[model samples]
Target: MADNRFEVPEYFKCPLSLEIMDDPVFLCTGSGHSFERNWLQKALDRNPFQDPITNIRYGDRLTFGPNRSLKAAIEDWKQKTNYHSASAQRPPSPPHRIPEPPRRPFGPFTPSLFPQPQFTPPPVLFAPSFFPPREPVAPPRRPRRHFIPCSPNRLPEHLLSRWEWLR
Candidate 1:
């Protein structure tokens, strides 16, 4: 069967994957082109650091900040058009299971044949009395020091003479 692709907006689609951007981000280049974060990261990892759209080298330090405006616009477009991704529309595959072998039934059902095991509750690890409650103790207060304020104009005669000599 031929795969039917959904008609996604060119701007909304990532340049690298050519699919709708799940987490769009700016390429941090002058062009300011946006691409899916994961796809861009994979491309950068495999190839040299550069802008996929413009094919411009960005050197070692390549940053891609989240394009919130573009993301919002894409979300708005999806809502307006009631668009769903191909992956989302595709039904999940059924899980694989090992088929059990058919068993022959016994002549008659008997409780004596298969005795039910008795269940015993586990012992409590922690008891209320194990930890006794105590009154909360307040933290120790630090000693306070009183400051003596002295104005530059109120200097003593001896200190003023020494200050002048130093100057």
Candidate 2:
């Protein structure tokens, strides 16, 4: 049964799966029908070289291609409708917060073996007048001649003139 929450277009669904196709494909059965690739593959696996809708036997000649237009249309529809899966639509479960263990105060009567260290604030340092202001560093320059030198022995007599300029 189809969910009544969002009114999905009739054409957006696969005829076999009755679900929105993630990867819609067109069967070359001359039926002008589109189906979800997964559903079509499953149908083909069961029947072997046959169209699920028309039940037309294609034998070894069975072929299909991605229904790009239909996929785009479905994506557009989903975006416009703000459609999300049932799992995504459902409210997230509340996170369980674990309570910290109660801390026992170490009084003079109950002396601890290890003493807690005192935290001191770090001192801030001002830049010295002797130091110059920081400047942006430029990247290393590349060699002007980027071409690789080819062996003279490998070059033809006619092409040697062009290769001479590279030297």
lDDT of 1 by residue, 108-145 (tens): 56335457688999999999789989889999998999
When summed lDDT is taken over every stretch of 10 residues in candidate 2, the lowest stretch is: 146-155
Candidate 1 deviates by what RMSD? 18.5
Enumerate residue pairs that collide in model 1: none
lDDT of 2 by residue, 51-150 (tens): 8888877758577899999999989888887887656779999999999976878677876667768898787575586578789999999879854436
The C-alpha RMSD of each candidate to the native structure, in angstroms, is 18.5, 20.7
What TM-score does each of the candidates earn? 0.49, 0.49
- The residue-level lDDT of candidate 1 at 167 comes to 43
Q: Report the CA-based lDDT of candidate 1 relative to the real structure.
A: 0.78
